[model samples]
Target: MTNSELAVKAVIDTWNQTIARFDSILDKLTDEQLENEVAPGKNRGVYILGHMVAVHDRLMPLLGFGPQSYPELDEVFLTSPDKAKATPPIATLRTQWKEVNANLAKYYAQLSADDWFGKHTAVTADDFAKEPHRNKFNVLVSRTNHLSYHFGQLILMK
Candidate 1:
C-alpha cells in the first residue's frame, strides 16, 4: 500500500480501537454508577456519555454519513452544563453510542484513499485545494483523541 493509504488505515484502526476501549470502560459501570459525578462539582458519568453521543451524532453530518440522529442531545449535553439540563438514562445513551459509532465505522470503511484526502464538511472544494491538510482524515484523528479524553473521565467513575 502507498504510504498515504497506510496512514489512513492507521487512523481508522486507532479510532476503532478507541471506540472499543470506550465500550469496555463503560461496560464495567453499573447503571447506578453512571449517575455518580467524576468528582465533586463535575459532571456525572451519564452526562459524559450523553456528551459523547451528542458529539458523535454531530460528526455524522460533518463526515457525510447522514443527518444527525440525536439533535435533541445538543442542548442537554453539548451546549448546556452537565447539571444545567436533565440527562438521559444510561440505556438510551448506550444505545445511541453504539448506533452512531457503528454507522460511523461503516462510513469510514467506505472511503477510498482519495476520499480520505478530500475535503469533508465545511471547507469548500477550492479551499481544500489550497489547504490539503484540512482533510477528513484529520477529523478522525482529532475525534479519536476526543474519545480517549472522555473515556479517561468515564474510567474515573469506576
Candidate 2:
C-alpha cells in the first residue's frame, strides 16, 4: 500500500478502536449509572455521549460528509447551547452513539488519495480564516485529534 493508504488506514483504525472503547464504556453503564455525575461541573455519561454526537455531527457535514442525521435524538439536544446541561436516557444516547460511529466509519471508508489531498473551504472565520482552505489530510487529522481529546474526557468521566 502507498503512504496515503497507510495514513488513511491508521486514522480509520484509531477511530474504530475509539468506537469500540466507547461501546464498552456504554455497555457497562446501567440507566441509573448513566445519569450519575462524577462530580460537580462534570457531565454524566449521557451528557458526554450527547456532546460527542453533536461535535461529530456538526463537523462531518463541514468536511463534505453527511448531515446531523441521527434523527432518533432531538436536534436541540445534540446542538443545544447548553449541551452539558442536559442528559438524555442512557439507551437513547447509546443508540445515537452507535449511529454516529457507523456513519463516521462509512465516511472514512470512502476516502481516496485525492480526497485526502484536496483542498476544502472552511465554514468558520477562526483559525483557518487566513487561508480558509485546508488540505483534506489536515482536516482528517484535526478531526481525529478532536475526537481523541474528547474521548480522553469521557474516559476521565468514567
Candidate 3:
C-alpha cells in the first residue's frame, strides 16, 4: 500500500481500537455505576461515553460526514458544569455510543487515497475565519487523538 493508504488505515484502526476500549469499559459498569462520579469534577462512565459520541459526531461532520444521528454534543459535555448532572440511562447511552462508532467507522472506511490527501478548509466556531485544515487523513488522526484524550479521563474515573 502507498504511504497515504497506510496512514488512512492506521487512523481507522486506531479509532476502532479506541472505541472498542471504551465499550469494554462501559460493559463492565452496572447502571448505577455508570452514573457514579469518582470525583468532584470528573464525569462518570455514562457521561464520558456521551461526550465521546458528541465529539466524534461533531468532528465527523466538519470532515464532510453527515450530521450525528445521536443527541446534541452540548447536551453531553455542557449540560451542566457539575459532572454529576443527570444523563441518559446507561442502556440508552450505550446504544447511542455504538451507533455513533459504527457510523464513524463506515464513513472512514469509505475514504479513498485522494480523500485522505485532499485539502480542505476548516471553520472555527469563534468567527468567520476559515483555517487551512489538513486532509482527511490528518483529520482522522486528530479524531483518534481527541478520543484517546477523553478515554484517559474516563480511565481516571475508575
**Best model per TM-score:** 1
Q: Worst 10-residue stretch by lDDT in candidate 3?
A: 123-132
Question: Candidate 2 lDDT, tens digit per residue, 1-158?
Answer: 99878887787777678777767766776777766664566666566667777766665666678566754344545545434344566676677777777787787678786687665545344544555346667777777777777667666655
Error in Å for residue 141 of model 3: 1.3
Candidate with best lDDT = 1
lDDT of 1 at 137: 83
By TM-score, the better pick of 1 and 2 is 1
**Residue by residue across 1-158, what tens digits does model 1's lDDT show?**
99989998888888888889889989989889988898888989999999999998898888777999999999999889888887777898999999999988888888898888777897888998899888888887888889989988888887
Clashing pairs in 1: none
- The local lDDT score (0 to 100) that residue 25 gets in candidate 2 is 67
Candidate 3 lDDT tens digits, 29-122: 6777767675565666667777776777676666777765664546646565545456666677677777777877787778797776665336
Worst 10 residues of 1 by lDDT: 113-122
| Deviation in Å, model 1, residue 32 alpha carbon | 1.0
Candidate 2 stretches with Cα past 4 Å from truth are 70-86, 121-133
Report the lDDT of model 2 for residue 46. Answer: 66
C-alpha displacement of 117 in model 3, angstroms?
2.6
- After the best TM-score superposition of candidate 1, give how far the Cα of residue 87 lies from its true spot, in angstroms: 1.4
